[model samples]
Target: MKKFLVLGILFALPITAYLFFASGKNNFARLPVLTEKVKDIDQFKTNTDSVISFRDKISVVAFFGSELDDIKGNTFNLDQKILEKYYDFNDFQFVLVLPEEAETRTQQFVTEFNKISESSKWKIAYASPQKVQEVFDSFQSPHKLDENSFTPYVFIIDKDLQLRGRDDDEDDGKLYGYDSSNVAELSNKMNDDVKVILAEYRLALKRNNREK
Candidate 1:
């Protein structure tokens, strides 16, 4: 009887473990795409004069407009709560879109930001106010930019240039962007969503390698 019980327990353990992990994988398989084919950043000019596109990269995008000082707190909240955590991940970046007139201010903002954290993965792009409006409008989200062409919220763009967010959020039924000023939102909701997307890509890479 004891030997039979031991054999049964041993067999059940692997099955139990498999079920547990399988359930977890299913739960986080992929983040739902809220918007498809968001406008790429190729039209904007970067400090390095290099083309920045949304192709094949996970990006956290924000619009600071021309007033960098105004959004300093919001930027810091996003940096500490989100960017600092995922900046080192492969093909993951923070894209801050600013108006063409804010070049000097943007440089100052970058210098100040670098004093506290690494800004290598933070790509700053400049565009005309008209172009900025065009790109923001491409999101098709319910939220709108403020008078300064700025918003406290930041959006998550997947590798395929699609927006990813919750369709059944408790507060906003359809959450399109996270408020950078809200640390709790960033720490709780945004962090989990980012993990889901990153895991989705990692799993894809593994499967592709296996097939090869």
Candidate 2:
């Protein structure tokens, strides 16, 4: 019994540390800006005209779908309303992205939203399933793989193509979710996380003006 107990304790340490630390470092290391974006519309319809590059400005990418009847009300509707409301606060583009499979459902959702409100705050688009997976897989977060892999997830990439905040990081550092998804999905509780990034962006603009 004593020998068995010692072996179990030894085995658990590496597994536990990997789960808590190692994988998260890989996720944090992935630069969100360089990832190719996919949307819910067809190729021809996708807004490739102004395809946002990390070189231009910071961007907020939210994966949204109303197709899953189970989560539409709680997750989908709330996602739209949040983007529409606080959109005026920053210059960053807030985009609505859906996978090819979610097209019909997303179209209906977008149309209904446009009817109820009038704003250019959100731009909707479509992308391929494989492409979306490629973006998420690069982070290799197993927790994210199980659920949000094929659906809506959020990522905030700074001008340098670094992923700063994510809804789900490996663990809470400084007890914060300072990730893109939290700001996109939760909207209220952790908005200051988003504000801090924006504040930095503003300061850069000020510095640039002074340099001129």
Per TM-score, the best of the predicted structures is 1
The C-alpha lDDT values of all candidates are 0.85, 0.49
TM-scores for all candidates?
0.87, 0.57
Worst 10 residues of 1 by lDDT: 21-30
Candidate 2: tens digits of C-alpha lDDT, residues 62-147: 55443545444434444454445556664666655555666666545545556655333456565565655554455333324233
For candidate 1, write residues 63-157 as lDDT tens digits.
87788888889988998988898877977988988778888777778888898878656898888888888888988998888767898889999
Error of 1 at 176 (Å): 0.4
C-alpha lDDT (0 to 100) for residue 116 of candidate 2: 55
The regions of model 2 sitting more than 4 angstroms off are 1-55, 65-71, 74-82, 115-120, 139-153, 166-171, 174-189
Strongest candidate by lDDT: 1
Q: Which runs of model 1 end up more than 4 angstroms from their true locations?
A: 1-27
Q: Please give the RMSD of candidate 1 to the true structure.
A: 3.8
